[model samples]
Target: IKRLLVEVQHVKNMKEKERKRKVEEKKDNRRWIETQREREKLEKIKGINTKKYRKTKKDIERKRKKHTKEEIEKTELERRWNKEKKSEIKKQSDRNK
Candidate 1:
């Protein structure tokens, strides 16, 4: 039946969304852990380290944090885009009916 097929597809979509949510959460947790580790490294660089070494470490940490933040932003944007596309498709289908 068309209705049954629609229900099955909806279930699949829900499952996929749940999976994506879990993956996004994992990425966020990873970003948090990396940020914490970077901060800890920066703190540790405060004592008995050469000024040059400290500067280099700080720069690397800054770049890494920036990279991770950008990646998270990108993922969120893609998710939003996909959500909008699905909504648009649903609207079009309704209009067709």
Candidate 2:
């Protein structure tokens, strides 16, 4: 009878050890998955931020080019008008003479 009791106790101890090992393995797997998710989220945010910065920079460059073009055209028109006015004055003076 004592021999039978000893055998039963040994079997119970083995079962308890196996259960503890399985619980530890499950906890490790869950922690790894959580860390992986956080890393992916940070990378996505970084990519979006970079794209917005590039688009804003391009828009500023386009605006500067348009302003420069308008200024150049206005100066050209003023120079042409001045030349025409000078020629007209000379012609009038010659006719009066």
Candidate 3:
């Protein structure tokens, strides 16, 4: 009878251990699911605002330089025009002699 009791107690202990293991596995799965949901939400929001995001300083400076190229070209053209006008006036004064 003592042997039978011991066998039964051993079986019960194994079952309790299996139950605890299953519970831990369920908790791990739930945590994994929660983390996946959070990441999905973050990705969705990031996607929505991707174009509106601020650039790093380096990126901002690079873009600034890119946009200024045309403006610099325009200013150079204006400077050349003013220089030509002044030369034309000097030539007119010389011809008046």
Candidate 4:
């Protein structure tokens, strides 16, 4: 049971790391998208709507893809709950022993 809790902890760590990485990636993407949109707006005001501008707009849209905050929080909770459950099981098993 101790070993099981160890495994659960490892899984939780892996999931949290993934969540953090994804959050960082989403933030980077948002920044890039906002920057691109700002540059495009500036170019449009300057009367320079080129193909590159269109491409950048499309790229901005692609960057808009992201997981909801609720989803991220749910996954994080699951990670914690699973680890806690393992610990609980260990306690029960020890009590039985």
User: For this target, which candidate reaches the highest lDDT against the unseen true structure?
Assistant: 1
lDDT of 1 by residue, 33-95 (tens): 999888767867665476767797799899999999999999999999999999999999999
Per-residue lDDT value at 92 in model 2:
98
On residues 2-93, what C-alpha lDDT tens digit does candidate 3 reach at each position?
99999999999999999999999999999999998887678666654443333444577898998899789999999999999999999999
Q: Find the number of clashing residue pairs for candidate 4.
A: 0
For each candidate, C-alpha RMSD in Å?
31.3, 13.8, 10.4, 33.1
Q: List the residue pairs that clash in candidate 2.
A: none
Better of 3 and 4 by lDDT: 4
Evaluate residue 72 in candidate 4 and report its C-alpha lDDT on the 0 to 100 scale. Answer: 82
Give residue 37's lDDT in candidate 3 (0 to 100): 83
- Cα lDDT of model 4 overall? 0.88
Q: Per model, how many backbone clashes are there?
A: 0, 0, 0, 0
lDDT of 2 by residue, 1-97 (tens): 9999999999999999999999999999999999977766775657445565567768888999999999999999999999999999999999999
Q: What is the clash tally of candidate 1?
A: 0
By summed lDDT, the worst window of 10 consecutive residues in model 1 runs over 43-52
Quote model 1's TM-score. Answer: 0.47
| Native-referenced Cα lDDT, model 1 | 0.92
